[model samples]
Target: MKDPVLSHVRGTPNLLLGNYDLTALGYTVDEYFVAGTAVSYRPVGELGVDGHWDVVPAERADYLTRAVTVVPADGARFNGTVVVEWLNVSGGLDAPAVWLMAHRELLRAGYAYVGVSAQRVGIEGGAALVGDLSLKTLDPQRYAPLTHPGDAFAFDLFSQLGAVVRHRGDELLGDLRPERILAVGESQSAMFLTTYLNAVAPLAEIYDGYLVHSRFGPAAPLDGRSILDPDTVASLPCPRFRDDLRTPVLAVITETDLVGGVLPGYCTAGQPDEKFLRVWEIPGAAHADNYTIQGAFLDSGRAPIEDLAQAFRPTDTLMGRRLDRFLNFAPQHHYVLHAAIARLDDWVRTGRPAPAAARIALTDDESPTIATDSHGIARDGVRTPWVDTPLAATSGLNTESDRMSKLFGSGELFDTAHLHRRYPGGRTEYLTEFTTALDRTIAAGFLTSADRQEILELTAITAEWRFDPGAFHQSGSVR
Candidate 1:
C-alpha cells in the first residue's frame, strides 16, 4: 500500500459530537480526505477460541475516507506522539469517543489526535445503534467523493491510516514528526480493534500501543458481520487478547461493560495480565457516563471552575430519553481514562509498564454478577476517592431499561441522615479523607497528578452543593 493521497476538506468536519473550541486550546482542527486502496483479510489457519488469529490478505478495494485531526497550531508544541482513534459508528455516524473522553489529556500533553472513518456504516447508510447520521447523509455534496468498500476492508483501512500518520507525517500532520503512534477505540470500535489486533496487527506492524476501551465479550468476525446480524447475534463467543502480543495494549473496562445489559459482558473473556497487555476494570463507572453525554464538550481546561461544576452534575437523561434514575456522575471514569493515555505513552516511550490494578469483584455464576459493598457501591476495582471516601452510593449496574440508559448506569445521592451518619465532622472531615484517597490513587498511578487540582475543585463544588446549599442561589443554579 503506497502513501494515500491527502486532500484538505473545504468545509467543517462533522465529528458528530464534542464541538469544543480547538483554537482556544492552542490546537487547530482539520479534515482531510484519505484516498487509497485497502486489503481485506481472511483466516489462513483456524480462528480459535484463544484470540491468536492467523490470517492473510484476500481482497483489495479502493476507499476514500475522511480523517478529522486536532493538532498543535505551531509545530513546536507537538509532543511527537500521535493518537489515531477508530471513529465509532455504533451511533450511525463518525463519533470520536476517545477524543471526547480524553481530549483534555491529549491537548495538555501536546499529542496530535486523528479520528479515522474506517467503517462502511460511517460513510454509507446502515442499521444504527443511535440515529442514521452517516457522512453522506450529513452532506452529500461535500462528502460525495468519500467511499468505503465495506467493513471487510476496515481493518486494513485503519492500518493504512496508522502508516499515513507515521511514514507520511509531513503531509498529514503539518510537517510535525510523530515519534510514537497510539491506537484507541471505544465500544464497537474496540471490538473491531480486538479483531485487528488478533488478525491484522502482526502483518501490518503500525501502532506502538493500543487503548481498547469498553469492549464486550466477543471480538468482531473477519467475515464483516454487523452486531445486528441475526446469525452473528445468535452465537457470540468471548475471546481473550492473544498472549503473544508484540506491542503494549491496555484494555480499560467499565462496570457496564463487565456485566453487559443488552450484549455479552467482558467478564467472560477476563484473563491474566501479560507482558504486553494489562486490563483495568473500573467500578462505579458505566460504559457511557455524564462526561460522555455532557462534560467532554464543556471541559476545555480553560473553563471557569464553577462552569465545570455546573457541567458535571447528575442528569436523568441520556441521548434524549428520560431515564428512570440519575445517570452516574462520578468523574473517576473520565479521570482514569485520561491517566490511561498518559500511562500508555510512557509505557511505549520508556519501556516501563503501567501499574497493575485490581479487577472489580464478581460473583461466581453461569452468568457472572458484580458484587457490591454495604452502600450499594461496587466493592473492588481501580479504587478512587469517589467510591472509597464516598458521598453518593454508585454502581455500574442500572435498571435494564433502554440500551443507552443501561450503559449510562445509575447514581443515588445520599440523604442528609446518611451523610451525617457517614461523616460526623461534616464537610471538613469528608474533604480530608477524600484528598488523602485522591493522593494515594495518584501515587498508585491510576490517576494523574496533572488532574489533581481540577478533581479537588470539583470535589469542593459537589460537597458544597450537598451540604451547604446556601452557597448557591435558591433557583437551583451554581452561583
Candidate 2:
C-alpha cells in the first residue's frame, strides 16, 4: 500500500533498509512514516500575524537514527516553527500505532504531531538481533550499546529537529521562527522525557512543555518505592537548571497501578513556576484499559473530523451522556485529561494557563479508608480504628473486606451487570459495618453528595452480606 502523503515528498525513497537484514532471517519489515498536512491561522493579539500547524510522519534513518517530519499548519507562511517530539512508552508497542489512534484530536487542536519509534527493539533489524542473541543472555554493558540506542539518540535528534524546523521555515513554512518546542511522552516514554529534559536543559532552549502520562521507573528494593528520589536519579535536577522556563508542563497521572510511587514524588517536588502537577486517579480502570473501557469520550465516528474541517457539527445528546458511564470511575481524573489537552493547545497557540480545575467531586475513601495522608501520618477513625487488637480479632473482617475492595475496585461488578444480584446472607453483620462506614464518611462531608448517591444506589441492589457470585466467577476466585 502506498502512503498518500509520503508519495509527494521529493527525493524520499519508497523503501529504506534499516539496521536489520529482514530477508536473511525470513522476517518481514514494516514501514512507518510521519505523514500529515498543515493548518494556518492568525495569532490572537496580532490580527495580521499568521501561524502554521504541521502533522509529520514517523520514520527510521541510519542505524539508531529515527527521523520524523514536521509539516507546518501553513507550510508556506512561517519563518520559524516548533517541533513536537512524541515518544512511546509501552515496552515493545509501536509508537506510531498509538499516535495513529489519538492523532485526530491533536491535529484539529492545531499542533503538529511527531511520533518517534523510541524502542529499537520493535524496529526492523533491531528486533532480529535481539531474537537471535536472546535478550536474556545479553550482558547489560554489551546490550545497552546495541539494543537501546534510541534512548541516547533521542536527545540529539530532538535538538537537531528544532534547528531543521527553524531552517526550513522560510521555504517549507512561511516567515515563522522556531520559538517554542515541546516533548510529549506516555508511560515508559514519560521516564525518558524526564531523562532527556535533565540531560539537554543547558544548551537547548527549544523545549517549552512536557506532557507525561503513566510515568514509571525502577522501584527501590527496601520499600518498593519508585526511583523518583532526587538523590537516586540525577536527572530530576534538570528542571532546576533552566533560568526562566517560560515553558509550562502538565502531567496526567492515571491511578491504575501507580499507587505509591514516582508520581507522588513528582507532584510534591517544588520546582518551576510554570510547572503544574495534576493527578487523575481513574477509578476502576485497569493499567492499560483506558482506551477500551473509556472509549465513550473519544469521538470514534466521523463527527469529530467533520466538525474540525467545518463540514458538519454533531448534535448527539448521547455524546455527553455516554461519557457519564466512565466519569464515576474517575471524575477528577477525566476532567484533568481534557484539561491537559486544552492547556497544551492553549500554550502552543495563545500562551495561557491550562483550564482551571473543573468542578469534580472528591471521594472520601479515594485511597484506602486507612491510608496515610500528605503529612505521612496514618489516619485513625472508627472505620479504620487504631486500637491494639489481636490479629485474630480482626482477621475475619479484614479478610472479607480486603477481598471486597479488590472485587469492587477492579470494575467487574459493573462489567457483569450484577448490581441487582444478592449474595447468600452468611456474613450480614460484617458487611453492615462496611456499608455503615461508607455512609458515615458521606455524612461527615468527606464524600460528595453524588458519591453518596451512587454508593447508596449500588448498595440497594447489592447483596447485604455476601460477595456477588458473578464477580467471583469472572475473577476465577472464591473465598
**Backbone clash numbers for all candidates listed:** 0, 31
Q: How well does each candidate superpose onto the true structure, as a TM-score?
A: 0.97, 0.45
User: By TM-score, who's the top model here?
Assistant: 1
Please provide, for model 1 over 181-203, each residue's C-alpha lDDT reduced to its tens digit, 9 standing for 90 to 100.
Answer: 99999999999999989889999
lDDT of each: 0.87, 0.34
Query: Per-residue lDDT for 344 in model 1?
Result: 96
Worst 10 residues of 2 by lDDT: 388-397
RMSD of each: 1.8, 16.3
Model 1 clashing residue pairs (backbone):
none
Regions of model 2 farther than 4 Å from truth:
1-64, 68-83, 96-102, 124-150, 169-180, 217-246, 260-287, 290-338, 355-409, 412-479
